[model samples]
Target: MGKILRAIKKIIPEPIFDFFSPVYHWILSLLAAVIYWFPSRRGRMKVIGVTGTSGKTTTVEFLYRIFTDAGFKTASLSGLWFRISDKSEPNLLKMTMPGRFRVHRFLYEAKKAGAEYVFIEVTSEGIKQYRHKFIKFYAAILTNLSEEHLEAHGGFENYRRAKGETRI
Candidate 1:
């Protein structure tokens, strides 16, 4: 019986090894779209995007604090938290990047909550996958560049291109 099960597993393609992968991602993308679209249709929002090898979280937090202090309703998605228009809490994402659609969704939710401003921490990998495509930024802060995630990006030049592409 064990041998039969093993044989069945071996016969299955590696890509088909996880049956839930496609369904899971589809659900997530749909959720993200719903969250972003509803609030955006209501009014205009000022979006601030921060991308770098380090200090993304700190920079986002600083901007959040400043915006809130100025009395604007603000929402921020950083390494530490997923904030929705003055209602911030710890990020519960099981995966670091979550999904390609998550950032857009979070922005959508913030907009729904009447957030005047939104801040996001854009990662190099996310940029590579074209996750930052949909959202328009009012301002972008590029803190600094460094070497990281060389394996996925192939080399330093590819990594730099991944980061630099975000600016265009």
Candidate 2:
């Protein structure tokens, strides 16, 4: 799919690509959810989403530690790293919230690993792109919101709305 997207990007003009970008992301997100069998739903895992203009990674990290220390199998995807229980690796993707398929795949893997809880660092851009879709969040935390990503989100209000959109 990655290769296919790259090929399409090369073939399509920038304007055309930009016009269809949202639809593309939406389809990919829904597809990923279906392919992963909606791992976070049906009470399969306690998915906690941490979103805000700042401190998302820190919150996710703290939650990961808290859950693991309490003897609950835990997984986390943050800007700094990705962890599954006792093992963790740096997040080389340079993305706080990864693409749709990657997000769903991680949730699926966490469920397979018997993780009781999963902590995810959500971002406003990710929510705008529908990357937060299909995950049944048990809890949603907004560390803090400020005037950031105004340009990308069009305005502060839009950015704030995007932050709130991550609740599901």
Please, what are the lDDT tens digits per residue for candidate 1 over residues 85-165? Answer: 557778787533445566776766687688998888878877765566556677788888888888988998988887776
Which candidate has the top score in TM-score? 2
Model 2 steric clash pairs: none
Clashes of each: 1, 0
Model 2: residue 18 alpha-carbon error in angstroms = 6.0
Estimate, for each residue in 1-168, the C-alpha lDDT of model 2 and write its tens digit: 779989999999999998999898789899999999999985568999999889999899998999899999999999998899888989999898999899999999899999999999999989989999888999999899999789999999889888889765
lDDT of 2: 0.91
Give the Å error, residue 139, model 1.
1.8
lDDT at 132 for candidate 2? 92
Instruction: Give model 2's clash tally.
Output: 0
